[model samples]
Target: MKKLLIVSLGIIGVILVLSPWILILFGRNQLHDHDIPQQEQLVDDREKHLILAIFPHPDDEVTVSGTLMKLKEEGHEIQMVCLTRGEKGKSSGIEDEVELAKLRTVEMKNAAELIGADHLHLLDYPDSGLEKVGLDSLKKIVGELIAEVDPDVLISYDSKVGLYGHPDHRLTGRAVEEVFLEKRGMDGFTPQEMFQVTLCKKQIKIALKLSSSFQKNYPEDPKQGLPRPDFSINTRKFFPRTLQVMQAHQTQQEVLKDLMPFHDKVPTWIYSRIFDREYFREVK
Candidate 1:
């Protein structure tokens, strides 16, 4: 009787442990269900320029890569600034921060290359320790990088970075905002008014609407308990390229495959865009 009781208890424990993952899988299917929508925007004739993306980790780029890929296809120079090496991710057989960071870096570079991006700058900050980094110091580093890249448009984590709410994402956002102010150049600025290419309320609202459907489908997502975001990018034109790029991150394949299984079911050219408001600050 005692042995049978022990077996029953073990099964219960296993179920409890796997409950979160099961719930997440269900939510993922819902999140990946939609076909990308088409969004039409009048393009202004201007000299081609760069769009800079600042992210806290390697995979963070995947969340917004669709828009970046679209912009690149449209001929905008794309660059990325990653803040950490993602050493904190657990390894089943491999363990060691130094080695893990190096491995992750290689993976990140490959992912970037797949998207035709040639410029990538890593800040070498400690993973999960971004909040501890002084705001002033972070601002200085990101500010200098921004000045060097000088992209026409910028993208990064939303104020409420999905699910994980990593501190690194918050700090990166703050640093980007500060850098914008410093570079606004009231005294030494060239633009005269402020940072150019700020996203307007209309654009932000459209993005937010797209994100609402994602949140509504995944109300049980522990990583993000919040409602839909207030901004999103129109992504139909670049969905295929984005999925291809996402598949390049082999280490994250299991999770990505489970969550983003649209590759087999959806049309390759389906339109879908990511949205975030944190990167939508007004420079002017």
Candidate 2:
């Protein structure tokens, strides 16, 4: 029995060691799984006045890609800031923190370009490890970007748990809120005073309720739900493009496989897609 136990343990250990590569090998399809010839929309304007997105990881950007793509196609000056390189993230299969960061940075840039936004900001902070970063450093880094972009509309994770409540996400919410309210009138700031920023509390709740309802009807599927959302953006038009952008994260194929189906099942006409909301206030 002891020998059998030993063999079992050895096999488990081998699986653990090889799991990352196996996931990567089989998951490579995720990277190239995009439907060819992205859908295009005919819109009136193609220049953004100013739109900015702040998120903790690469995929977070897609939470509101439909609105963003529309804005971009309409010619809104768009910019995105990814706080971390997602180095701590398990994707890309590279264990070296430095290399992983570099890889994700490239991946993010590629994703941003696909979205028609060339200005992508990478803070290069430690990934999934914001709890270890200096608060002062974080505030400053985020503040500088806010000042530079001075975006008319800002989107980010709800400081609350509307978007998975990751610590890094929370930090993004906190930092952006802090900077948006306090960094006004600072040098290099191009203020967009009338801009409306969107957040995801209500939509998350709606997604949750809807997900619960679906799960109840179809218990065979794993239960997943988001919180209710106040607003819903129809992203079906942008799914192909967004899917391509999200696929750039090479390591997040499984996540896509799991979530995309749910997202697709959502009604295209009334998908409860909500983003968190925090707007800038001029400094006193």
What lDDT would each prediction earn against the true structure?
0.58, 0.57
Mark the regions of model 1 whose C-alpha exceeds 4 Å error after superposition.
1-45, 91-93, 160-164, 181-231, 254-284
Report the poorest 10 consecutive residues by lDDT, candidate 1: 271-280
lDDT of 2 by residue, 77-149 (tens): 7788888788777644668877777777888888888888848887766777776886567778776777677
The per-residue C-alpha lDDT of model 2 at residue 138 equals: 78
Model 2 residue runs over 4 Å out of place are 1-48, 91-93, 183-228, 262-284
Taking all chains together, the TM-score of candidate 2 against the true structure is 0.62
lDDT of 2: 0.57
**Residue 218 lDDT in candidate 2:** 23
Instruction: State model 1's lDDT.
Output: 0.58
Worst 10 residues of 2 by lDDT: 274-283
